[model samples]
Every structure is written in C-alpha cells, then in structure tokens.
Target: MKKNLLVFFCLISVQIIVSQIRNVDGSLGRIPRRGSDSIPDNEISVKLSGKTKYTDYKIISHKNDTTIIDTTLTIQKEYKFNFLRKDNFELLEFHNQGQTFTNLGYDFTNISPFPDIGFRAKMFNYFHIEDVNYYQVPTPTTEIMYRTGMEQGQVLDALFTTNFSKRFNVALAYKGIRSLGKYRRSLASTGNFRVSFRYETPKGQYTIKGHAANQDFFHQENGGLTPTALEAFINDDPNFNSNRARMDVNLSNAESTLDAKRLYFEHTFKLLSSKDSVTQKDFSNLKLGHSFTRDSKFFRFNQGAPTTGVFGEVITSSGIDDKTAYIAYNNELFLDFNSKYVLGKFRVKTMLSNYRYGYENLQNSTVGITKNKLKGNAVSLGADWNGRIGNFHINASGMLTPGSGRLSGNSFKGEAFYKKDSVFTIKSNVEISNRFPNFNFLLHQSSYDAYNWENNFVQEGTRTLGGSIASKWGDASIALTNISNYTYFDENSKPVQFSGDVNYLKLKVSKEFSVGKFALDNTVMYQKVANGDSVFRVPEIVTRNTLYYTDEWFKGNPLLVQIGTTFKYFTKYKANAYDPLLAEFRLQNETEIGYPTVDVFFNARVRRTRIYFKADNISSFVLKKNYFSAPNYPYRDFVIRFGLVWNWFI
Candidate 1:
C-alpha cells in the first residue's frame, strides 16, 4: 500500500512539472487576467472580451434545462469529490471503491415509471438517458478527474466536447476504475463510454439529438468474513489489524458481472413558423417529434465451487454459473402546440414498447420449470403541459397503459415553483405511480437450489407529496409517502411482498453559516416509518456537520484554499444484509450497526484545477472495532487519499 501511494504521488508530480514547463502562467502560479494583452488562446476564440464568454459553454439536460460552466471552490464541491461524483449524504459506502453502497434512507419521488432489470446495487454507476449530458461550447473543452483507489488501482473520468459550427455540436466521455480492496478476494473493475451529438437546421425549424452508451461492471465477491475472522476483527486483534488480506472469507472463488448497451435518438420538426418576435407570446406554433430507443442488459454470477454452508445446497459442487438477460425497444410519436389560449405548451404522445426478459433454458431442479421468458408488447398514451402563471411556473405529466399485461400501469407527476430572485424560492410536487416489481422478483434462475423461483405478483402502487422552501436563510423540505404491495427480498434471499400499506415521512434541512474566514455547514434528516416497520427500516436520524476555513493563499489571489473537518452520525438500526449473488440487500434482524465517522480534508483551487486531500475515518483509530457496513462486512479504516479535477479549453 505504501509503495502504491508513493508511485501515485510521483505520477501526479510529473504531470505538474510538465505543465509548468509548457506554460509560464501555470495553474499553480499567477493566473493571467482576461484582457486585450493576452494572446489568442484556443482557435475558436479571438479574445476573452469577445462574444464567447464563460456563459457560452452550456450543458443541456434531457429535460431542456441549461446551465453554464462554473469553476469555483466551495464546501459543496468537496462533498461531491468521490467515486460516484455526487453528494452521497443519504448513502453509506463499503470499505472499497467501485463497490456497493448501503441505503440509509429512501426517496420515493424518484421512482421510475417502468420496472427495470433489477440488480439495483450494480446500477449505481450505470448511465441512463437522463444521466447523459449534451454540450454547446464556443471552443473545445476538456475535463479530467483522477482519484486514488483502495490498494493498487486508480480511477479516471475524462470528457471532451467541441462545436463544429453554430448549429452542430458533439461530445465524448469515458469513466473507468480498477480497485483491489484490502480484504481477501475482493476486486472491482468497471468502465463506461458515451458519445452524444446535437444538430439543428439553419432556420431552427428542425432539430435532432441523441447519444450512445456502453457500460460494464465486474466485481469479485468474497461474501464476507468467516466466523473466526469476524471475531478477530471485532476484538481488534493486533496480528490481523494491519494485515487484512490474511483474514478468511466466506467464498474463495466467486464473482458477479453486469453489462449493458443502449442507443437512443429524438428528432423534432416545426410546422408553423412565426418571425414576429414582439408578438411571440400571442403567436401559435405546431411541432411534430419522434423518438426511438433500444436497450440490452444482462447479469451473471460464477462460483468455482459451491459452499453448502454459505449459500445452502447446490445442484453440483463442481461449479455454479447463472445468467439472465433483458432486452427492450421503445418508439414514441408526439405533437406539440404552443398557443396563448391554452396558457401553456401542450403535448400529446403515443408510445409502443416491447420487452423480453428471462433465461435461455428452463430450470430442471426441484423448483420445476414454470416459464422461460416474459415477452410482450405494451401501448401507452401520455400528455404533458408546461407554462407559467404570474410569478409561478407549473409542469405536469401523465401516462397510462390500460391492459392486463405485465407493463400495464399508470403514473402522474406534477410540480409548481415560485421564485423571488435571491430572496427565496418555494416549490411543491406530487407523484403517483403503479408498476410491477423488477424482472428478478418475478422470475430468476440460478444453479443453487434455493435461488430459482417464479411467481405472479400484483402491481405495486406508491404516492408521494412533498414541498420545500429554499432561501438565503436555509433550505428545508418535507415529504410524506404511502406505498401498497411493497416487494422485497426476505432473510432467506427469496422474493416477498408485504400485504399491508406502508406510510413514511421524511424531513431534511441544510444551512451554512460564514463569519470572516471561518464557516460551518450542516445537514440533518429525520425519518419515521409510521407503519410497516417489519418490512421497511431506516435510521431515525442522520446528520452531518462541517467546520472549515477559507482564504486566498497568495498576493495575487491565484490560489484559493479551504480546510475542514466533517462529523457524521446515524442512529442504530437493523441494516439490510447484502447478497452478492443477486446484487441485492435482504432483510436482517440479528445485528444492528450504526456509528459516527470523522473526516478531515484540505482542498484548494488554482485556475481551472481543484485538488483534494482527505483523511477518512480518522476517528476509527480511537473508536471501537464494532463498525460494520453489513452483517459481517467491516467498514473502512483510517486512510489518507488525494485527487484532483482539471479543466482545459482549446
């Protein structure tokens, strides 16, 4: 571990030295001010004061929200500098990178309208249509992010985007990681590649946008520590404290993998044109659009030799291999009308979807062969409305597929927002949906006798209503949700559904205070399961607090520095146990795991580069050895890590 750390730092040092030699105004040195004295930088720009400004570099989302590029240092940025590259306040990660995370809370508002292929644990790093971004930049833009892994590996995410003309733009990105964990027989490697394009006609009458993505995740599973190993870890034996690889694990040669590929495109053409800009609000226009999508995914599990004690009895002790696949295709056509009479833009769409998911052959074990596949077609109709009234903006969408097929269901979601500049913003939303569980819960196949099953279950229904207030004072949100026919895995790793309805409530608040060079940021969440505690569980309270100092480092303010220490804690609960075979968490009532963690970090920004250095789980050294991410899986130990994010324009 020490040698790997030294080599990683040396590579970073070499890059910094090369950059210094290539440019006198280096990132760590004096940053050149934007003025006429500066020479032409990228070929796309003549001068910094020209029409091409920082705001010209745009990032567009699937919902058509546009945000400009921003390079700044803040505590929020520090929290997002991790494996997932997002704020994981509601998640607890395992000891290694590229591994799975335990759920500390649930958010019903983000549920999907349709069921997925299952294996939610492996999908954390997966990229969906909404997760991809389209770029429109004045010049070629590039961003590179690098981070140190657990023992002998690293992670890198790189992106590059450029505009060929004012009407056409293209972007490419790839993220890959390889991590060899400190534990025995635990290794993870994953990769994702994406390319997107956006184009429009000269008259802006026609537009098209699409992307292609390929991703795969592979992880070697050791199940967890053995009984003797668990005892040694809990007792903090000196012999095994520093040498984790010497410990015993449940499975010696077991692995799991997930692979996926997708292709999508959407095009629109305007039928009515109006050149009157002053009367645009009163003018009417009509547009026609079409979209097509195809997706293929599969999950597989392999074991060299089955362990009867760990996974029950298997059909054969020589070896075990299990695989399942899901393939889907969707086509949609829509018409949009923009008029003053309706007070908003209205759209009506019709979609046809086809799916096939299951194994290639039938199971001949004691479970018996029921069905080999679930293949069918679903037709759906939907409508959307978006507009504003006075100082408020409203958006709503509803979709229905009326039939007795597997995909037949209905969903409706609506939101309203009112904002008063920087003073405050108030928002409210409601979502209701009825959908079937994932494919795994319906049908699964495995070499192990206890892992194969097929069942007919009713559609699960959920409704969530929430509101929030965001202002200079703080940000707070509250939500109430009710669920019927909730499906989950039992302690024995079998699919099950709760008979009664479940009700839950969540409250979250965040605030930051600054005084001079010192600042404190805090976030807290409270949750309650009004009913169905036996089926649903979460910590009663979770909180994170940070106290940091910020200041300009040099005379010319070329460097910005922030140093902080964060403390996080959650109440004890019977957290769900992990099942690597299915990549799912099952119900557990034996042990309760919850504890506090402390992390210290020093972050700095120099021009377009941001550097981070952190000491995670610093309190673990002085605390007890009872910290566990799952039943027998221990949490991360004290370790120091460093990484950086850099951006360049050409």
Candidate 2:
C-alpha cells in the first residue's frame, strides 16, 4: 500500500512539472497580478478590469477574521511546512510524521468551559471545528501540498474552492498520511475530509455558512524499547545504529484508533437597517442569529496478547479490547444590536447543549462493575461586546451556567489592544474558567484490572492575565496563571488532582536582524513554576535560531532562493512518560532528556509553486545518541526529505 501511494504521487508530480514547462507563458504558470500598473503599498484601489488580484481570494476564520491568499516564500513558511501544516515552536514531535508530540510549553489563556473525552496524546493530529476554514474567491482556486514521510510513506493535502454565483461559494478539502516508521510496531495512518459552504441574500439581509467533517487516526504502539535495547541504543552500538528495526520493543501486537465526525452551521438575519446613508447612525443593523453543531467521537485500543510485566495483570489473558465513545449537540440563539452610543456591537445569547460520554455496556473485572455513561443536558447564558474608543479596541465574552450540575461553570475572556500605524501595537488579555474533569477521569473501564476506576472529582478552576507588545524593535509577551484543583495523570497511570494552587509564569521574545543578503531570526521562551512543581512541570528555557541568505536567481527573476540552517535547544527537566493503553502522558521524574538539534534546508519558489528540501537532525551524527523524546523512546535519527506546494487559479 505504501509503495503504491508513493508511486502515484511521484507520477502526478512529474506530470505537473511537465505541464509547467509547456505552459510557462500560459495561465498555468502565470502569477496573479493587477496588470502592469503599480500601486503604492499605502494606497488602496479597486479595479473592475484586467486580471484579478490575489486579494480577491479570501480566507475567513471561525472568529470572522479575514485574510487574503499569500504566495510569497519566507522563513516563516519554511517553519510551517510540516506534517501538521503549522508552526510547532512549542511542541516536540515523536519519531514518525502522524504520531504524537510532547508539549514543551502550555497555553491556558484559551480553554473550553466543558469537559471532553480525555486521551490527549491521540489528539495532536485531530482537527476540531475551529481548525476548519471557509473561503471566497472570484475564480476557481486550488492548492496542493505534499511532503515526504519518515520511512515508507508520505503526506498529501489538497483543497479546491469555487463560487457558483455572486453570493454563493463552496469548498472541499482532504488530507491523508501513511508512514511505516523505522521502529517495530510504529506505523501511523490518518485521514481528514471536510466540505464547507457560504451563502448570502442579494439584499444582504440574510447570511449563512456551514461545514461538515469526517476524520480518523490509527497507529501501532510498541511501548518503547526494553531495558537492554535502551542500553544498546544509548551506547551507540554499531550493529544496531544504522538499522533501528533490530532493536527489541516492549509490545509487539498492540494498536489504537480514534474516529470523529461533525456537522455544524450558523446563520444570521438582519431585522433592521440604517434610516439614512450615514456611517454612524444612532441605532442600526439589528440581527438575529442561530448556530447548531453535532459532533461524535470514538476511541479504541486492541492487543492480541498482553504482557503482564509491562501493563500488570489482566482479567482475561486471551485478548484485550477497550472502547469509549462521545457525542454532543449544541444549539445557540443570539440577538445582536449595533448602536452609535455603544460604539460597536453587542450580542446576547443562550445555548442548549446535550452530551453523552462513556462505555456502551458494563464491564465486570476484579476491581468492580463501573458506570457505563454520563449523559445530561445543560443551559448556558452568554454575552459578547466589541467596541472601539479612540485608538483602543476592546472585545469581551462571558458564559455562565448557574445550577450545580456536571457542566455547571462560568467562563470569561477579554482583550484590549491599541495600535499606532503598523510599527507599534500593544495588547492585554484576561481569562477565567471553571469546569469539571474529562469523562475518563471520572469513570473508566478496561480489560486490564488496574485500568478500571470510578471517582467523584471536583471542578478545576484557572485564571490568567497576559500582555504583549509588537513594534519595529521586536515582539515580546508575558503571562501568569493560577490553577486550583489541577487534574493530571500520576506516575502510576491513574487520574489525580492537586489540592493546592499551582502558579506558573511564562515569558517569550522574538526578533530578526538583517544585513545585506543575510538575516538571522531568533525566538526564546522562559518558563518558571512558582509553586506546585510536582504536579506541573516544564523546561526552564527553550530557544530556536536561524541564519539564512536569500536572493532572486536567474535573469527574468524566474526563481527565488533561500538557503538556511536552524538550531533548536532546550533545558533538561522532568518530562512526562506516555502510556499507550490509555493514550495519556503520566507524570514521571525518572528521565530528563533535553538536547540541541540542527537542521539544514534549501528552499526556492517559481511562479506559484514553492519547493522545500531539508536535512533534519544533522547534529545527531556527531553527538551522543542519548537523545530521547520520552522515557525509553529515542528521538529520530538523521534523514533528508523534499516536497512542494503549488497553487492554481482558473
């Protein structure tokens, strides 16, 4: 299967290359432009004739922010061209492409006010509703992104969008990956498919948008190397240094899978409009809105045979299979009011939510018979405010559920910002949330005797205040948080909550310097645990630096090239250990693994296509082989790979 997919993609790539060569002077290889007329960077104009500008293609975020399509090549693009298709500065990836990541840092500023199905280790590659994107374009647009995988497979993401009429648009996208890792029982495969649509009435009185998605993730678990195999790996034994498959693993026949599907829609109708043509009317544009969402998820773990030494005794040694499922529905109705007195817009809303999460039937083990499910409904009241005063813009939202139910809690997030041109900007934000622990923490059932549990945990609460500044000099941010009833997995792979308050502080800064055709980009982060370090742990410092040279090559500026190398390092600390059975990370103090890595890259751009070539972890060849992503799990070795991203408009 892996070889077939590789061959298919290679054939398509060759076909596209040939087409580009044949149509360099035609539409296929021509860049989007606004004719030969040049417009000043500070000027804004609308042209009804000639070719369409890149700004005509728009991407709308879940929060209503909009940005135009960008086809430029830069260092930032290099950082984001990965399996996740995003910048992973705060994360450390495992050995394979579709596997999990270890959190180098945490962000508590934006958290949900409701509990979910646990097993966070399996959610790194999963896509939530907020990750989906909508699009609007004057012409049919398509984008294809491909990347080589770790050992035997690759990753591909394709997107297409088009407008049927002046007021209607639709988009379809899919991303799939398969990688047979170098280690035994480490294969990973995943797929994500989504479709989105948007429509508006000709009078601009009604607007509607929605999306549906289906996703699945599957991976084999080996439970890392055994004690003897670990010693040989760290000692740099020449016999097994080049061939990693020869190493012995703890588990040989265990696998885990996660599946999810969602359907969502939101619509708005304007009840009233302005009385005159004035921009600032006393009262104008009253709107009524409704939003609906239904999502379902399932997780399963299977083992043909159990290892008593690794996972403890089991109720039945024949085989083990564990499954958990979750389903939720949310309906929100809101009224929006726009008035000159209020400066901007205000919204009042109420949400009705229903949830069911747990096992399907009762399981009787040596421990006891555990509860099957936690099902209930909740009603929440919410308010949102957005306004601008002089040079400052303020936005805030709050939601509350008064009763003493499992979903009973309150959440609030507010932000204020000031900007003076594009050179200087400052922002401040605050967040507060109180919610119950995940379903697995409250109730769980498994074939293993030690994995079944039932508990009544209290609601966890957290508060945070943060501020950031961005100017021509650089960018900097600082945040401090206080957490109470912090829930986590203990070293024994059991759910536990901290009783005392945990205080944490984080500071980060980034800057770039350029001289001639060379530039250096640096980003550094510092973290400190003021109290309760046992339950909450993080590295003291993490940093990444890149030095690169860029220039236009060839005569007619047919190509643009960038050559660079990046170095990343972090301080050693008590990192967490991963548990495959529950797909969770447990707190541990036994292993402290931290080291520096170097990666070299040569990237170039031609027309609307961007090519990437990278040699990752070159430092591993010269340094000691003591690096580990987690306890007993070694980091990946040196490898070279290449791929490309291309865009087409019709």
Candidate 3:
C-alpha cells in the first residue's frame, strides 16, 4: 500500500506540473486586469479586505483562491476543527481555549485577562468586537452557510456586501448556532451580528474604517452527571441503557446567558505621500489617526430550582436571578510611518490611549437585593514595529501603564521569523507581561453560596520564550514559561493567589505522510511541570492521528473527495471538577478522567460548495463507557451529522 501510494503521488505531481506548463502559454494563466471592458463572464475579480487576520484583502482573481473552497471541505485540514465540530470556531478543548476553570491542558503562558461580565462557558462562541472586518465588493455579493447536527442542532451564517462607489463599501454579516445535546441540560445557542463600512477619498489622502457588532450566547448548565448514574450507565444497567436523559444530573434548571455590543471607528489622514512607481497610487509615508471604541456586556444566570446540594448553600431565595453588567470606553491617537527605507518595507506605529471600565452587579441577600458599582480608569502608551531583513521578518510591540489604576502594568512581546524560500521556516517569540486579575476574580457576588468572593489580589507576572520550525514534512514547537502570583480557584472553590512562582515546559510536533492517494497525519504534545503540578495539572501526553484517502471524481475533476478516520487519545490524569454556580471549573481530587476517542468522516467539494458527513465516537460500543471529556461529563455518544457550506459571488 505504501509503495503504491508513493507511486501515485509522484504521478499526480508530474501531471500537475505538466498542466501548469501547458497553461502558462495560454490565456487561462493570465489574471484579468482591472479597468478591462471585456471581462470573463464566469470569472469574478475580487479584492477582499476586512478582518485582516483571516484575509489580507489583496486583489486576486476568484479562481486563484483555492483555500476558500478546498480547505473548508476537509475535517482533518485544521487541528482546531477536530476538537470542536462547531461552526463558531470554538475549539472543543478540554482546557486552554478560555480561562483555567479546570485543570485541563491549557497553556497559561498565553492566557490574558480581558474585561468581561463573568459568564464564560459561551464566551468562546462570541465574535470578538475588535476583529470585525470592512469589505470592498465590486458587486453585490452574498454567502449563505448552513449545517445540521445529529440532534436538534443547526447553524446558519449569512454575509452580504456591496460597494456604493469605488471609494466606499458596506457589509453586514450574521451567524446563529443552536445545539441541543443528547444529554440533559446541555443546550447551547449563540447569535452574532456585525455591520462594517470603509471609505477612502478618491485622492487616497484620507480614509475611515468603522464597525458595529452585537453578540449573545445562551447555555444550560447540567453540572455534569452524578457518579452513581454514570457508574450504572457504564455497567449497562437495564434502567438507563441507551437513555441519556434518564441519567441523574447535578443541576437541572440553571441557565447562563451573555450579551455584548460594541462600536468602533478609526479615521486616518495622510501627512505625507509618495507616488508608487509600480501600483501608480499614492503611498502614505506618514499618517495620523484617531480611534474610538465603546463596548458593553451583560451576563445573567437564572435557576428555577436552586439545588444547594450541587451548588453550595444559597443565601438568596430557592429561585435565583443574578445579573452583572459592564461597559468600557477607549480613545486612542496614533502616528504611523511606512516606507521602503532599506532592504524591505519598514513600518512603525506609536499610540496613546485612555481607557475606562465600569461594572454593576445585582447581588442577592437574605434581607433583599443589593446593587454594587465599580469603575476604573487607565492611561497607556504603546508602540509596535515591523520590518524585514533579507528573507527574515521581525515584529515587536509593548505597552506601559504608568499612572495609578487597576490596569497599571507593562506588557512586551516580540517575534522574529526566517523563511528559506518556500521549503521551510523558523520562528521565535518572547513575551513578558504584568496583568491584573479578571474583574470577576477580584470581586463577585451571586445568589449561590460558592459564587461570591472579594479580595485584593496583586498583579500576575508571566514570562515565556517559545520557538517553532515548519517545513514540507511537518511542524514542531516548544515553549518554556514562568509565572508569579498566579490566581486561581482553590480546592475549596474559593479564589486564591499563589505567591510562589510556577515553571512549565510544553513541546508539540506534527507530521504528514502521503503515499499515492493515502495520507497519514499525526500530532503529539507533551507537557512537564517543573514546580507546580498541584495547582496546574495537565496530562503528560496527548496524541491525535488521521488516516485518509483523497481523490477526484466525475468529469473535469469537478468533485474532490476525502474519506478518513481520526483517533485521539490522552494520558489519564486528575482533571479538575466544574462549579456550575460560578460557571467555572475548579480544583477537585475526586475523579480522574482520560480516554481514547474515534471519529469517521467523508468530505467532498464541488466547485464553490463543500459538504461534510461525520460519525463521531464510532467505537463507543466496543470501548468502555467510562470515556469522559471532563470529570463526570461523558463524551458525546456515537452520532452522525451532515452539513454543507456554499459561497456565491454575484
């Protein structure tokens, strides 16, 4: 099989090269130039720019962007998609995607505190207010994407954009997801909307970019299953066989919801410009800009029947209603300098910012209800630089808050990378920061007994050094980190600050091999604690493997298909427990969980449309039912799901 696959790969490579050579002398290889009166009827020339991270907004013929159609069709294409098969890009991580509620394998070195209203479970699905993109579409363009799950789960995403003139454009996008789990009290839903606009003067001396976004996330907290019920279900007790809803849960009538709204605008004017010889457009060498941002968040938790046994003793009524709200405002002024001074283009930005955050929380007590308000202000100076030297690129940025405020601290980050043609690349990064604890961790009050806390915790300081190498074969990376004054929830479910320093090391590697039409890909990660395993526990090893076959079907190769299976396993370890009232995973020594899981999938793409069909946990019938993603929380059962995504340009 291996020899056959290798020979097939070689043949395909040769065929592709020959096809490229043949097309080089034909009009098929030429990109249609702008301002052409006669454009290809089937071709669409697009310049996409908005969210710069996902896309660079470069002008390109639609036929050349294969990733938009190819990558989306495969489940094994990206590591993030394997963990959480959700449309919101939220990795189904055991830990690390957000905060450390549980001792899951999260890289604390990369965690940062953001001002939030305290609801966390669903925040992973919320679209970031700062990452909204502005679009420039020549004609009205619309894209609709829909997906269906095994249960009553569905996801719908829509986007529309149009240009009123060549100089101005506007876009609107909305995404909604609802997944009703087979387990009790495990329903999740999210709704997100964004509107953005971009405008530039005909002379290209002035420009404006702005966007507004709103997001809401709702979740039902089951507090996991009971130990007795789990054991019975694993033992194939006749009462609960194949009946998930019959299992006993810790909580049944609790819900957590969060809503956020944000508005941002930035305007820039060129102070100096030079004519670009190649593009024949004015290039701004020095630019002045001002930006304003306002963000508001609200969180609410309701329990129809508060169970004191599951969530500590409650000081409020049997039925509880708790709410928290926060608002933040930021103003910034910056100067940007961009030019080709030496070997490559150099860019630098220096900025001054003023920030304000205020919050109000409704606390319940035996006597009645109380409202608490807290506010803080900070002023910071920041700067960033990016430049290239030969085939290497470097970027560095830092910010310092000198005045007296809750956010008075300094952060520094730097990275450098070198690419050797297209064969391989090496990169290194370093980060040092002093950050305050989250507002909720500092002061929070709720109706549940274990959900209230108030303490003055010092700043947490972290330093990390990491490096990675990527080549045609695979990628490898390592990181070393040290943290001081770590804050976390203790075994007692109370917030505590660890004064001692903790050191950690993590290493990861991934590789892919292809033989003919068969491909095998594997990834493994190892984490070691030099000092603090009691506080920060993680599995020693985690591994994932995928084996697949790929081929083209039908005439003209219009259909590309891949059939594959994925296996993921992690070493058993003492995973942390979760606290529903706090919407947090806390330290626990009661149960340790780690298990192996398997999934099979078929993916195909036809032109601009992609289809996916998957059966997750296919080995559940043969494997032990003790498989748990977190303590007491059984992983999903064997289920089939199908979905499709389509992009249209009109």
Q: What is the lDDT of residue 596 in candidate 3?
A: 82
Note the residue pairs that clash in candidate 3: 5-515, 5-516, 6-516, 48-57, 101-585
Off by over 4 Å in 2: 1-50, 280-284
TM-score of every prediction relative to native = 0.93, 0.94, 0.84
In candidate 1, which residue ranges exceed 4 Å CA deviation? 1-50, 275-284
Query: Residue 339 error for model 3, in Å?
Result: 2.3
- Model 2, TM vs. native: 0.94
- What does the lDDT come to for candidate 2? 0.86
lDDT of each: 0.86, 0.86, 0.67
Ranking by TM-score: 2, 1, 3
User: Could you tell me how far off, in angstroms, the CA of residue 286 lies in candidate 3 after the best superposition?
Assistant: 1.4
Instruction: Indicate whether candidate 2 or candidate 3 has the larger TM-score.
Output: 2
Give per-model CA RMSD. 4.5, 3.8, 9.4
Per-residue lDDT over 1-650 for candidate 3, one digit per residue giving the tens place of the 0 to 100 score: 23323333443454345334323234223223222335442344433321112122222221112222122455444333321334221123431112112333555443442335554555656666434656664444455555663367566666666577877877777766666767778776767788888889999789887889988777788877787887886786778756787888888899887889988888889898887797786666888888888888877788997788876678755688877777877777878777656433333433343333323545645423343565777777787777797888987777777765566788888889999998999999999988777677776777775676666788888899999999997999999989898777788778888868888888989898889999998888888888877877788888888899989988656688989998888777787676666666667787777778888988887755677788878888788777776777777778777766655443
TM-score between candidate 1 and the true structure: 0.93
Worst 10 residues of 2 by lDDT: 40-49
Task: Give the alpha carbon lDDT tens digit for every residue of 206-270 in model 2.
Answer: 99999999988899999999999999999999989889999999999999999999999999999
Better of 1 and 3 by lDDT: 1
